[model samples]
Target: MTESLRWIKSSYSDNGGQCIEWAPEHANTHGAVPVRDSKNPQGPALLFPAPQWSHFVEYARKQSV
Candidate 1:
């Protein structure tokens, strides 16, 4: 089920190994965001509500500054 979802890494993620991927399409279609470690595609995914996910991303962006 997870394999069918398209995952995208953060643009800020380089080849440095630490990376996470999220399925935005899944969020749009299902109203929940699926996030997982990019290095572990076969691993478990953490689902978050769209609004919570948006807030998380926003907070992350602010913290990066």
Candidate 2:
């Protein structure tokens, strides 16, 4: 399922070790967001429901990191 996904990292990222990649295209069509650590492309990905992903993003955006 993940093999065909076109993963994309956040524009806000600095291309550092602490970065994640998500396939927005897939999420838009499937209603689930696929996310994985950028440093580990071959690793397992976590699939979150669209609403949950939105919440997670909102929370992360408000963090100090």
Candidate 3:
């Protein structure tokens, strides 16, 4: 975790507040995506394998639509 992460908020997030953020640049180079709640920037982030995280996100997108 020595790398500087540029966390991007989820596109689906709105002002309603509950949201998540992910480090895409880290995922692209490291094959693991770090995700955290936007409300707690200092809290621990969960790491998910890039492929698995992609699949989960795709599934979630489909389910919501």
Candidate 4:
């Protein structure tokens, strides 16, 4: 795991500390979205393929931020 990956926040994350983080750069290179908790950098991460990640983002964007 490297900080070189640019982690982006979920749109659903607004004022609260609760958030989901993903590495867009990693996706560009690996074709997989590496997701983790913003509050816990060293925590476990979940990896989703591009299509699945797109669907997840679509669903997240539809929710209230």
Candidate 5:
């Protein structure tokens, strides 16, 4: 099921050892964002409501500023 989702890494990920990937398509189609560690593609994923995911992204962006 996960293989069917289009997962993308954060643009800010600089080939770092630690990275996170998210599926925006899933969010749009399922009303929930799927997030997972890039290093553990086969591991469990965390699902966040679209609005909550948006807030999390906005918060993360601000933290990097």
Candidate 6:
């Protein structure tokens, strides 16, 4: 799982300390989504299947910030 994984943070992320990081490479090849904190790259990542990730993004989009 450590090999061939390329992680990147959301472009909207700023130094204000709120950010989201994702492993797009893993998602493309394995159909599983990986999310983690920008502040803790070595921390545990939250893995979600493709469908679940889609639903989660949709739900989040509908909420007011």
- Judged by whole-model lDDT over C-alpha atoms, candidate 1 comes out at 0.93
Worst 10 residues of 1 by lDDT: 9-18
The C-alpha local distance difference test score for the whole of candidate 5 amounts to 0.90
Q: Which one is best on TM-score?
A: 1
Q: How many backbone collisions does model 6 have?
A: 0
For model 3, the run of ten residues with the poorest summed lDDT: 1-10
Report the C-alpha lDDT of model 1 over 1-65, residue by residue, as the tens digit: 69999899988888688999999899999999999988889999999999999999999999999
Per-residue lDDT of candidate 4, residues 1-65 (tens digit):
74667788866468487888999888888999899988898788888998899997689678946
Give the TM-score of each candidate. Answer: 0.94, 0.90, 0.90, 0.77, 0.93, 0.79
The CA lDDT of each predicted structure is 0.93, 0.93, 0.87, 0.83, 0.90, 0.80
Better of 3 and 6 by TM-score: 3
Query: Stretches of candidate 1 above 4 Å error?
Result: none
After superposing candidate 5, which stretches have Cα over 4 Å from the reference?
none
lDDT of 2 by residue, 1-65 (tens): 88999999989899778999999998999999999999999999999999999999999888957
Q: Which prediction has more favorable lDDT, 2 or 3?
A: 2
Task: Estimate the lDDT of model 3.
Answer: 0.87
The TM-score between candidate 2 and the true structure equals 0.90
User: Which candidate would rank higher by lDDT, 3 or 5?
Assistant: 5
Candidate 5 per-residue lDDT, tens place, 7-65, comes to 99988799776998999889998899999999999998999999998998899999988
Better of 1 and 3 by TM-score: 1
- Model 2 regions lying over 4 Å from their true place: none
What clash pairs does model 4 have?
Answer: none
